[model samples]
Target chain A: MVELKVDQDKCLGCGNCVVACPVNGSISPETAGGHGPKTEDVIMMVENGVIKLFNEDKCTRCGTCPLFCPTDAIFLE
Target chain B: MVTNTKEVKGKDICVQRISPEEKRELAYKDDVCIGCGICAKICPTEAIELGEIGAIERTGVDESKISIDEAKCVLCGMCSSACPVDALDLKLDEKSIKDMAEYPQLIKSAEISDDLCIYCKACETACPRDAITIARILPERSKLVTGEIEIDKDTCISCGICEEMCPADAIEMEHHEPTSSDPTVSSDITVNKDKCVYCLICRKSCPVDAIKAVCRSCSYGDYDLNPEDSETTGSSFIDEEACVNCGWCQEICPVDAATVEKAFEGELTIDQDTCEACGACVEICPCNVLSFPEAEFGEQSDKVQADETYCIYCGACENVCPVEAIDVKRTAVKHTPTKSKSWEKQLSELKT
Candidate 1:
């Protein structure tokens, strides 16, 4: 299992990672049907200029979030 | 024994030394000095001290008394050159430094011109070194911090990326000497995620296969359920790694989701000489934004006028044209509906 960390101070709230995430876990169940699987678990969320991790367990460790982060705020261990 | 005596004569101040040989020295003239403090502020040796007099005199009035220590003065004339009022009469024969001529060797950093700045954070994002810090002033107390952008000179590499990204032309690469070829022509493709409706047309139209629309399908936690009885759900995602930044998606997007910035140097142009005026583009246009003048009997070609505001830049007209005369360097695409009979009817019905 990969450990994912988000530096809250560094997040610019650009939402690029949310758009780039291939997994449906980040999206809400209501909006997930059209794009991906409808799941109760959500991996990531953005609010108030910061990206928050909702369900770290649901993350697939695809390493897409850290790559797309413009500020390089997210890290994978 | 030699004693130095200073005497003020009208606007001119003369310093005289009383010894066997009397030497006369002329300092700054007070008549032309507006007391702007540019000289005192730019002084490297801190030789000039300007004293404030009153509240009314704080703003541009020359009520502040300026005392210059002759020992500390480097005679660099930087203060004299920076003075906006031309009050500092440092007899140094040199022209005012036009935008830091010697700054490349003397100073290595990026500087912002407050007067030309609009507080845009394009430079902040563009800086690879993360040296620039922009403190946004609150709406109510904006006057307190008009110019709040600070650049850490030590971390800055003087790469000039900030200068290129500055939309208002505010950031200056002080270390780089101004040259004819200094202005960078930056062309970037951008996406406004809010306007995107997830219409997959752009992904399908991408020539490089740069855009990937991955639709994930899964059954609701029922692995044992029969295939026919299970419900499948799906979502779209764009792969940034695969994207070549060709801006084809920007042209094909139905909404104003994607944009290509040309920075006013119009790259899109219709060649008048080669255009056959078959009206194929004008006819095929979905938005009715393209129109050409009615040709005379012998004329085979006429200029096509594109209403930029209404254009979605779908490239449908460009794809359908037979002559390939239209050359559109797709800069931007926007979804603006034209009011037709059907639209009016729909609007009227909705009003009720």
Candidate 2:
């Protein structure tokens, strides 16, 4: 199990993490109702032009998203 | 029954055997083999013998063909698994082994396909065991075909780093199966072309000559004031003929809009009509190209002059001026001396 957090102030909204994530449906754009949890409960979504962790349960803890973040906004604990 | 006996050290050696249940055969595809001899070396039971090219030519067979003795084969499937080009096939229980699927503990060798190889040397640097050797087949020929990569099975540990590092995907790992721990995922730097501003800061910082960026417009020119006032003030303009494309402006720009490319040549000129006699340019000039001629009493000091031959065209003075008086451009008229030395001396003597 792992925890994911996004620093809204530091994120440039480059969407580099979205492209680097190996898991599908893990990172996506935020919707009006916010992102609902998929089959894999872990989800990262963009809301108000910044990245946010919608759910943390489904994450595989691969840490690929953090590795690709150019601004170092995403943190995994 | 055994036949084809040969005497070795006074002992009879049986090279051929006939048995129903123990029958195992190895097939070779002659056209695909590059005569690398990787398969014959990796065979655990020594059932496959790779003959020399000269011997094979005399025997009227393909130079790369290997002889497989069925009697000595244990059907461990090492030869077929190690073949870089699917050139060898192993048959057991009359069914052809379709997949060379087995993660052997020791990887004795690896092979690369010459046709698919781009000779990038990513594998040569990535190999941890130092077993791979890439040489030029013909130094005088084209560089594309010059690299001929070979692996020494005796020294290879089957780490599979070469396969993972190959940019062209030309290398194939034999005997040792790739595992989740084998570092399959490779990292690469990618740029979004649409989002790029072409500032060329990356190009300036690069230690290697990998990134090339060229900016043709005055967008890369640095001005202290608004860019919209460029036409009205003519404060900053790059002389492309003089620019060496060193990317110094690109590194210093705050907006990341600077690019170094071909543009018109410019010479420094002062507009006498708009002159305020400000000495900011003279003080800021690194090259001391701008200077104000001393004026005597009753003589007006209203203009600044630049020595055109000494100017490096760095645009430092143009950016520091409060009033957009100095125009650094290609077409500005040269400044002419309005005061004579005799007139200045006569005026000074009268004032004293």
Candidate 3:
């Protein structure tokens, strides 16, 4: 099983990963529209300017979240 | 013989006047111009004409906000020197007079350090004029790792254990009634293909052996890659002509990467006695310095608050206020020392 790891120091809380995840778009249309998801049911979200992993079960393991990260903070290991 | 030429090249509008003794060129950047019409007003020959600024701004049409008459323009550089945003650039014989120290320059500058920048894009979001731009590049995901997962629905008991144990939120449990009040409590579980990261957490946590997951990279040969190849990298650029030196980028940058020297120093005040508290200034403020206090009872008060930390003193808020309660007093303007009498007069007019 691959592990999802986030380095807090490298994270700028940019929300790039959250918006890039397709699962987040399915959970909330706002994410697809390029804004943060308003609901709490998504795979990940930016909380207090930092990203927080919520429902990991909903992730398709598409590797999209880490692909769009500008800081390389989020990654699958 | 004398010759004149005009060329509009990708937002860089240029008008040239050539003579045997000297060559003069005036360049205007359509993207950098704020449509303030200051050039039109200051043009000595009245060659500059402003377009429908209000309509252009409303419709967001891709059109230049100002037009210049090539034949009438004398290329004196008056409008260029007078322009606040440096949208107009006048060059004499390949070099500008400002560069040669014959003309004064604005004492304003902006710097963004690539070393300190984290590419959070806060500056881009906070910039009042959309002057800051950010671009980011990341590694390809497929090249990094691969995995697969499958659920045996027939053998699955639908106990909701996998749903609870899943780290990716990829599982869901649904109940199916058997028509009668059957004690079996028939139920099933469905896996969301989009969310399943094949983490195997649900597979290990399940009481029954129903989930099968595999990490190809782990079992097979790991992808040969360097750590730096997986690194994210990008840069941010600020348009010199579009940036007003407002310090929004400096103030919003989380890493202290952006720095700006403001053009004008001033005090903005709203007279409470005359102010209707219509929040017009708050809506019109470009720097986001003015905002109404949060109402507790779902009803707003007649007071507005101002955060003066990043204010550039542009006078936009004052102009938009209908009650005439807002006052913007410019005490100083940042400009290089000048010898021109008319420029000094204009500079004096700014210092109220």
Give candidate 3 misplaced runs (Cα > 4 Å): A1-77, B1-20, B23-31, B35-75, B93-100, B138-199, B204-207, B210-232, B272-285, B291-293, B298-305, B320-323, B339-342
Interface DockQ of candidate 2: 0.01
Chain A TM-score, prediction 1 = 0.73
Which regions of candidate 1 fall more than 4 Å away from where they truly are? A1-77, B1-6, B10-26, B53-64, B92-352
Rate residue B62 of model 2 by lDDT: 28
Clashes of each: 5, 2, 16
Tens digit of per-residue lDDT, candidate 3, span B110-202: 888888887888999988878889887866554555577788877787777888888768788776655656544446667776576667788
**Residue A55, candidate 1: C-alpha displacement in angstroms:** 57
Model 2 CAPRI quality: incorrect
What's the fnat for candidate 1, on a 0 to 1 scale?
A: 0.00
Candidate 1 Cα deviation (angstroms), residue B251:
40
Quality class of the docking in candidate 1, CAPRI style: incorrect
Residue B120, model 1: Cα distance from true site in angstroms: 39
Where does model 2 exceed 4 Å of error?
A1-77, B1-23, B54-64, B100-352
How far off is residue B139 in model 3, in Å? 7.0
**Most lDDT-accurate candidate:** 3
| Residues B1-352, model 2: lDDT tens digits | 5332221221111132236655444556654443335455556667777543222322232234455665566655555554534456666545555432332211211234444343444444433223234443322111112122333443444444544444444444443344678633322233334333344554454444344554323353343234443222112233322232323343334444344331113577676654434354565454446788777889977467676543434354554443456666532211222244532232222111
Q: What order do candidates take by lDDT, descending?
A: 3, 2, 1
